[model samples]
Target: MVVLKLQSAQFFTAPCEIRSRKRGNGQKFSRIIRCGIAEASGEPAPLGQKTKYNDGPFEKVFMTLFAKKMEKYANSKEQTKKIGWWDFLYDYERFVDASKRVMQGKNRMQQQLVVREVLLSMLPPGAPAQFRKLFPPTKWACEFNASITVPFFQWLVGPSEVVEVEVNGIKQRSGVHIKKCRYLENSGCVGMCVNMCKIPTQDFFTNEFGLPLTMNPNFEDMSCEMIYGQVPPPFEEDPVSKQPCYKDICSMSNPSSSLCPKLLA
Candidate 1:
């Protein structure tokens, strides 16, 4: 008989077991016991256990659009059809790889411009005008926008909820608190998050859509906050732009430099 044990100090719970038995006709029977508490409570699994991500129709639509944009930007001949969770991650990593190649000689502003253009391409025709008309720069508009963002952006940023935040001395539910940013966690590239996602998204909303916005990403926990109707600071003044590489976690990290090399590229 073989027995496997997995214990975690954080989750002090009884061990769940899996048993296999040999039957009379030389056949084998297996019984699997899922962790009931975690499953029922909607909590993450215990330590050392791997979690599988699932994709929905909404996620697939966005992934397809993003992949198409990246494919065009990189001038690749390949077409991406499968937008499953894992496949989407692979495609995102490939886009990052292409960013390095295509943005090698570009300056910081130019790199941001490239990403911003890609973002614009993904949107529908006159989306900015429609968005501006729908959601003006007001507390009620921002709060409604924030509430709807959770469902729309869940695939890219993982689970998130609308949170009340103080903006200009007024409290409003115009903030989205991401439990963990899947883009940051999966890519592990601070530059990619900043240049490819953070800057472009903020600029897209603030400039194109005529709505002020900001994104605060915490590298330590891979969490993030999206605040609508809040003006984002310039790149030179933003602390995120000055953040150094995650040498320990990122595979493409440059330890010798103080900042991520991809920031300029």
Candidate 2:
């Protein structure tokens, strides 16, 4: 058996202000703002272990079953290559089809067992039994904030090797700075612009299950530039007076040509 271990440390923080779109009333707008600091350190275990199985006939049965299901989708050589052996077994389509069969009073538990067997057949050869423990479901949530003084190395010149990456307002300790850019022309947005962004998760779910579902924006409806800044003003918004907040900055019609002044230096 081969084992590998890894460890790393990192720090990040951001201050965010969320503004809600105004209702019909003329009252002043109320908003919630959050600021916080976050840091973490951890060591990671090696990826996976090897094991052996004695059930040869059962393995062949699962391989045949999964291949039959994949035949419908595997048209070209490129498609076959893209659908790896493991995916042929548990691809979302198979899951939904089996679910429907179960709901229709077919061999429910037995069909599920077939799916599990197919997955087991796809595991890398000699994988350890303990590998099953690694498949447990998990969830995560986090928040952060912070500020800083200066470092000693700013004095050095002549093509500095260090790279700085900043996200939201927090900068990374090292590596080339990566700034988010707008997806659409004339839109001062980065990462993802709600109007232009297309997430594949919803399509994957809908296509496999024949269900119509759309993943919508979670926050208030606002221009992308407000959430993620970009180089020049991408596009113009409607007039300020007509908008929920009657301030110049709130208007989408008039976009400022000024680049982020901080980046200029």
Candidate 3:
């Protein structure tokens, strides 16, 4: 088993504010303004052994399941490269690398589609058919979002929070700040970040829930903001959509840009 190198410091993200389109009126999440603790109410599953990072075993199982599902959904050439539960111990971001690898050789568009599809496939049995909807269930959106999505997000990926932001002199929290994004930082592909994670996630939430969302991923620091109740901008108007690969420094970089299907003719 690989010992995880994930440090508590790597988990720290200076929550940044995104210019929100609308000031939220809901105060249901006031207690979680700056910190979100993903408490699972399910019968406590086995977490296996404790890691030096204090990560339990259950999350490892979750990651393995998600990773395997992603690999299965993508049907990439590297089928043998399935991610292991122990990998989370080596580093929480290892799953990101595993995700990118599965989608390797596919275009940004296909990658996006595959991941969105995977999200649905990974849903628990008897999960709502919300993924097939045009908008979130207008009724009880906040309740369901808090009960289901927030905890699942923390389990499936990482701890997320909502920081207080003053909008027009009103201190209201309107979004989730992911201190570390497993998808963006490891993909190392600007187009992948845009198409796979940024665009699809926004569309998925807004369509599945009545609440509109806008996800802004800051490449330099691997931090991201998901503003709820805010409509996302079009492809042309979004800055991350126009970003280029990390000039020769990206893990997936190559001499020819042709490999990046977003630029493909």
Candidate 4:
């Protein structure tokens, strides 16, 4: 009996299947398949499992590259601070921590502006123009954009799927529904999610790339929807601008205030 140990979670003994395949050396390889995670406990698998990354080598490379880029743009002075080499999740947490540090001593508008610059710095030369030309505000363009966002951004946002949304009276698959946002969960700060992520991302896609994008975040569950081809409202008009802090999760949360203290900073 060959044992196929799962690295993620415990497997159910009854809901499993055994299979065999012959290798090139005439060796029989035994494989076991368990019932899908949905039927059991919804402990979602790691993002790397859904990609071509074998044993997390590619994930480590990508995470390291992105983390260095963030630190470079955020002007992080702590050169001695190092993100985890092998632990991608810990690296992500460090990345968010860097973002929070960027917001220190900065007002609301300045925070958003600096984060937007960091995002633009990460992109290649003329990427904004290329994206604008490739993805115009059309049904097919929006749908295709949504489909690609799932795999391309799953590392940062976690598991997400393309969802259908109505834009300008036309139904299109231009929405990306995130199961749970990795950044928000890691930071646990409403201000970080808004200034560092939501506002900067919206500005990057809409202004820089010429593709109007809106992000609607559910602070209660940490789920979010990214709708391409939809213009994000101004901070003065959007309700998220006045959103309260996460009382239990955020260390800087002010329970007495109705709105996030950082929102007024």
Give the best candidate by TM-score: 4
lDDT of each: 0.68, 0.25, 0.53, 0.70
Instruction: Please state every model's RMSD to the true fold in angstroms.
Output: 10.2, 26.0, 14.3, 8.3
Q: Cα RMSD (Å) between model 1 and the true structure? A: 10.2
How would you encode candidate 1's per-residue C-alpha lDDT over 139-216 as one tens digit per residue?
998887787677556556666789999998899999999866766766677887887789988998899988899999
lDDT of model 3 at position 3? 17
* Displacement of the residue 210 alpha carbon in candidate 1, Å: 1.0
Candidate 4: minimum summed lDDT over ten consecutive residues — where? Answer: 47-56
Between candidates 2 and 4, the one scoring higher on lDDT is: 4
lDDT of 3 by residue, 44-137 (tens): 2222211112233445565566666666655444423334444334234555555766566776667777877877786765353544353363
Worst 10 residues of 2 by lDDT: 140-149
Model 4: per-residue Cα lDDT at residue 28? 67
* C-alpha TM-scores of all predictions: 0.73, 0.17, 0.61, 0.76
Q: Model 2 over residues 52-79: C-alpha lDDT tens digits?
A: 1111222224434644543333322223
As for candidate 1, its clashing pairs are none
Task: Please state the error at residue 42 of candidate 3 in Å.
Answer: 27
Answer with 1 or 2, whichever has the higher lDDT: 1
Best candidate, lDDT: 4
Model 3: lDDT equals 0.53
